[model samples]
Every structure is written in structure tokens, then in C-alpha cells.
Target: MRLGLHALGIGTGAEPAVIRAVAGAAERSGFATLWAGEHVVMVDESDSPYPYSDDGTIAVPADADWIDPMIGLAFAASATSRIGLATGVLLLPEHNPVIVAKQAGSLDKLSGGRFSIGIGIGWSREEFEALGIPFERRAARTADYVAAMRTIWRDDIASYTGEFTTFASIRVHPKPQQRRIPVLCGGNSDAALRRVAQWGDGWYGFNLRDVDDVAAKVATLRGLCEQVGRDPAELRLSVALREPRAPEAGRLAELGIDELVLVASPPQDPVAAAQWVTDLATDWQ
Candidate 1:
């Protein structure tokens, strides 16, 4: 299985030197991808229940240094030629689809098609409210947004009509080097799994408990794929392991996962973070 590193564009990893060094080290050490996550803003206090933790609160402080994932990955791209750069999950419902498509296409073109997008219908109600976007029907919005983006990417004179977006006879330049930018949908809800079946090139599961959890979800995804007449094998499966019981890289591969992303707090310094990459790659092997 391929190994990836996450959180490279949050907190200390947001530093330019650190991102460059870690991305280079990961590439040199045979890591397949470098992942960054984003939250546009964090509220000091909110009723939003953090789904990944036992406690209903996120571990990140409101004032943590959070870089925009795309911008951070663009920096990483300048530093490394081979390692794949991806968003662990970009909150799709919070942004305008046309803008996202432009940014994504530009990045992909510059990066020589080494970029993939992992997107999610955001969970934090407060963040959505802060962005002046409605929290409800986010999944539908996500689907519509993705469709609109794909249309922009695929057609010279793109036109799309959807519930949340509409455009006509627009041409987006500098198309991605790849024919299609792989879209990995994030979340574990039935709705999410269905999105994986219907919309995603893959499913990206975060903070999953163990191999068993992955197995169950993969099975569900396979069933959903069949329901939609999509071949299960055609979809990539990536998981970020955060739980103590999370299995080793080999074990995750045995369960048909294409990639295993190790979620760890990256060091602040470039040298230290590069060493961190080498050490994790060594451990993974």
C-alpha cells in the first residue's frame, strides 16, 4: 500500500520552509502523497460537535495557524516534483464552485497533474454561518458544486444549471494535465458513501477506528457502487488512521485500501519535519 502524510498545511506545517522540506523528504523517502486540510475559520465556542473525537470539541485552538490547503499545496508543489499533493478534505459547500474550479485547474496545470481534491460537505454549522452559507442541504450543494466544477474543467464552452449554481458558455483556461482531477469524497454517512458511488473517483475515510471499520465501510461502498452500477474496484479507497487500534500499512492494504494516510502533528522546522518524513517512511516500510 502507498503511505501518505496529513496535516502538512495546518499549524506548524503551514510554514513555507517546513512544507517544502517535508514534501521533498516525503517524495525522496517513497511516500506517495502529501495531504493538507482546511477550515476557513474556527469559532472560539460553538455547538458543533467534533465528530472525530470522543469529546464533542475539536483539539485545535481557535487561533491555530491554519493555511489554505490549495495555497499550501501550491508551495509544496514548488518544492517537490513527484509526491502527490491533495486536500485531506476541502469544505466544498463553503466556496463558489467557479472559483474553486479555476483554482483547481490552475494548480493542476502548474503541478503537472499531480493534484487530487478530497472534498466534504462541512459539518461545522458555525463555520457555515460565519461564511454566510446555509448549513442545511450541504450535501446537495456539494454534489452540484462538483458537477459545475467538472463541467468547467471538461468543456471549452461550459454550461451548467444546478440548484446552487448556474453558468453559460464560459471557457476556463489552463485545463488540468490529467483528463480528470480525481475527486475523493470524504465522510462515512450513507449519504457520503452514496456520493462516493455516484460522484467520487474514491472514498477518503478519516479518523476511522481500525481495519474492521474500513472493511465495513468498504463493503457498504461496494454495495452502493453496485446499486449505482459502478464497479467497486474502479474506486480508490484511502483512509487516515488516527485511532490507537489502527492497523499497520500492510494490513490496511490487505483490506483493499489503496492508500493509508498517517495523521500526526508535523514539526515546525523544515529539517525536523523532513526527518519526520524519513522516519515515518522508514517505519511504514
Candidate 2:
């Protein structure tokens, strides 16, 4: 499996110049991809249980400088040519699908087709409330949004009518360089696996604790693919490790992880963090 850097430290490491330095260094050092995630707004308190940690705590503080993943990726794309840019997982249900389709297509165009989308139905009820999106029925809404975006991406004069979003015949220009932007569904629940089997290009597992966790998930995914009549080999299986390094990275690869992304930071210092990640990335690749 290849190594990718999920820029989790950006909450603190986020100077414009610093991002450029780190992204440039990542490309120069041969890391395969650089990923960012999205959180447009945050509240001081939420009943939401964070799933990616041992104890369910949202890692980033309420006042963190979490930039829009797309914009950060745009900045990263400008700084580096070869490394892939992704939203590790964008909150798809909280925004307008048509506008997002346009933005993602534009980003792919700008990046020379190096953009991939990771998405989820999400767990934060308060976040859904803040966006005025209903927390219940999110799964159905997610499906509709994905279908609408696909229609926008795949059609010349696109029109889609769905329960959540509808549009008349309109031509959206500058289609993505790739035929379809890869959609990796995040979350490991049965519903998530079904979504991946039915509509996604891959599965994106987050904060997977170990190789055993990954293996069991992959096995379940394979069975889901069978039930859906989709070939398992056609899917991209990637995982995000919240820890800075996974000693079992190769072991996970052996169990069928195509890409393994590790959380990293120069959390306290940009230049120093940049150089630190730069040095580690050299050996990682």
C-alpha cells in the first residue's frame, strides 16, 4: 500500500506559507497523496460521540482554524503538481449538491484530474441542526445527493429530480478530467457498506485501530459487494490512521489496504513541523 498524509495538524499548522511548504515538501519527498477534511462550523458542546478516538472526543477544539478542505486543497494543488488532493471525507449532506458538483469538478480541472472525493452521511446532530439539514433520514438524503451529483457530472445537459434536490436542464461546463470523480464512502456500518457497493468507487475507513479491524471490515465489504453484484476487486479500500504512524502499515497492506493515510502535524510549529513531516515522508515513501 502507498502512504498518504492526512493534514490533521492544519488546525494549528495553518499559515498560508506553511501549508505551501508542507505540501511542496510532501510532493518533493514522494508521498502519494495529501488529504484534508471539512468542518465549516463547530460548536462548543455537542452530544455527538466522536468515533475515531479511544474515548469519543472530537479532537479539534471549537476555536480551531479549520479551513475549507476544497480551498486548502486548491492551495495545496498550487504548491505541488503530482500529489493527489482529496477531502478525506467531505460532509456531503450539509451543503448544496449542485454547487458542490461544480466546485469539485472545477477543482479536478485545476488539479489536472488529481482530485478524489471522500464523503459520509455524518454523525453530528448539532452540525446538521446548524446547517438546517435534518439529522434523521440523512442516509436517504446522502443517496439522493450522490445521485444528483453523478447526474451533474455524467450528463451533458444535466437534470435531476430527487426528494431533497431538483434542477431543470442546465449545462454545467468543464467536466472533470477523470470520467467520474471517485467517491469513497466513509463509515463502517452495514448501511455504509451497502452505499459503497451500490454507488461508491471505494470504501474509506477512518481511525481503524488495527489490522484485525481492517481485515474484518474488508471481509464484510466483500460480502456486501457480492450481495450487490459488484466485484470487490473494482473497489479502492483505503483507511485513515489517526496516529502519526502505523507500525503495521505493511501488514494492513497485506490484508488489502490500497492506501493507508496517517494523521500528522507540525502541530506546534509550521516550519519545524514542515521539516519534520518532510523528513518522515522521505522514509515513509
Candidate 3:
């Protein structure tokens, strides 16, 4: 099974020196990917319930610093040769699809086709309000945005007509080095499962409790794929463990997990943390 470390571009290691050091360490340690998650802004007090947690509150403090995921991945790209870079889950409907296509394409090209985007319809209504974007029908918006972005990447001169995006034939230069940059859909809802079967190249299920949880989700996803006439084996399946459960690695692999992501905290000693992770990976392998 492939191992991915989550937390390259957030919290303490978000700085240039730490980012470079950690990214290099991770790559040298044989990590398959480095994932960066994003939240453009957070409201101090909001009614939004954090879906990943049992409690209806977010783990991140409202005051936490959130660097842009693309910029963070760019930093990681410049530091590594073979390691993949990905957004854990960018809030898709908040930004313009055309701009996202350019950014994603540029990053993929510059990184030698090592970039993937994991996206979701955001949960924070207040955050959307702050950005002056409508929160309703966000799932539909995400679908349209992804479709539009794919068109931009695939065509020399692109044109797409979608509910949220519409453009005439126009040139968008510096297409991605990869024929298609992988789009990993993120979430655990039924809608999310359908989204994966319909449009996503992969499914990213985060904050899973254990191997059993992963198994259940995978089964659900398989059923959804069958309903849509999609081969479940054709899509990559990745999961982030909610808690450290090193012994479950083999079981996860048995269940067909492509990558296992571990949620990391801001380390006081980034080098030591990297070494610790490397040791854990070695043990798992």
C-alpha cells in the first residue's frame, strides 16, 4: 500500500524552510504523496457543523493560519523529485473554475505531472457568505466547475457551457503534462459516492475511524459505481485514518486501499517528526 503524509503546508511547517525540509524528508523517506488541505477563511463563531468530528465543532481554531493549497504544493514541488502533491480537499465552489484550471494546469506542468486535485462542496455557509458566493446548490456547482476545468485542460482552445461556467472558444495555454490530472472527489455522503462514480477519477474518504469503516465505505462506493455502470477497480481509493492505527496497514491493503494518509500535527521538531514517520512507514512495510 502507498503511504501519504498529510500536513506539509499547514500549521508550524507551513513556512518556507520547514516546508522544504519536511517535503524533502518525506520524498527521501519514500512517501508516495504529500497532501495539503485548504480553508480560505474561517468564521470565529458559526452554526456550521463539522462533519468529520463526533462533536459539531472543528478541530482547527478559528485563528489558525491557512496558506493557499496550490502555493503550498508549489513549494513542495520545488523541493521534491518523485513525490506526488495533492490538495486533500479544496473547497471547489468558492472560486472560479477557469482560474482553477490555469492554476492546476500550471502546477501539474511545473511539477512534471505530479499534481492531483481533491475537491469538495464546502460546508461553511459563513465562509461562503464572506467570499460573496452562494452556498445553495454547491454540489451542482462543484460538478460544473470540475467539468469546465477538465475541458480547459483537454482542449487547446476550450469552450464549455455549464450551469455555473460558460465560455466561448478561447485559448488557455500551458496544458497539463499529464493527459488528465486526477480529480479525487472527497466526502462520505451518498451524494459524494455518486459524484465519485459519475465524474471523479478517485474517491478520498477522510477521517475514517478504522479498517472496518474503510471497508464499509469501499463497499458502498462499489455499489454506487455498479449502479452507474462504472468499474469500481478503475477508480483509486484513498483514506485518511482518524486515529493512528499502524497495525491495520495490511488489512487496509487487503481491502484495496490505494493510499493511506496519516493526519499529522505541527511538529516542534520537523526533522525528527519526518524521521519518526519514516520509521513508522518502514515498520508498516
Candidate 1 minimal-lDDT segment of 10 residues: 241-250
Candidate 1 accuracy as TM-score: 0.97
What are the RMSDs of all candidates, in order?
1.3, 1.7, 1.2
Query: Candidate 2: RMSD over Cα atoms?
Result: 1.7
lDDT of 1 by residue, 146-203 (tens): 9999999999899999999999999888788884799999987788899999979998
lDDT tens digits by residue: candidate 3, 169-223: 9888689999589999999888898999999999889898778888998898899
Candidate 3, residue 176: lDDT? 91
* Candidate-wise lDDT, in order: 0.87, 0.82, 0.88
Residue 102's lDDT within candidate 2 is 89
Per-residue CA lDDT of candidate 2, range 229-269, in tens? 98988998888764535568778778788988867655456
TM-score of each: 0.97, 0.94, 0.97
Flag regions of model 3 displaced more than 4 Å: none
> What is the TM-score (0 to 1) of candidate 2?
0.94
Q: How well does candidate 1 score on lDDT at residue 79?
A: 88
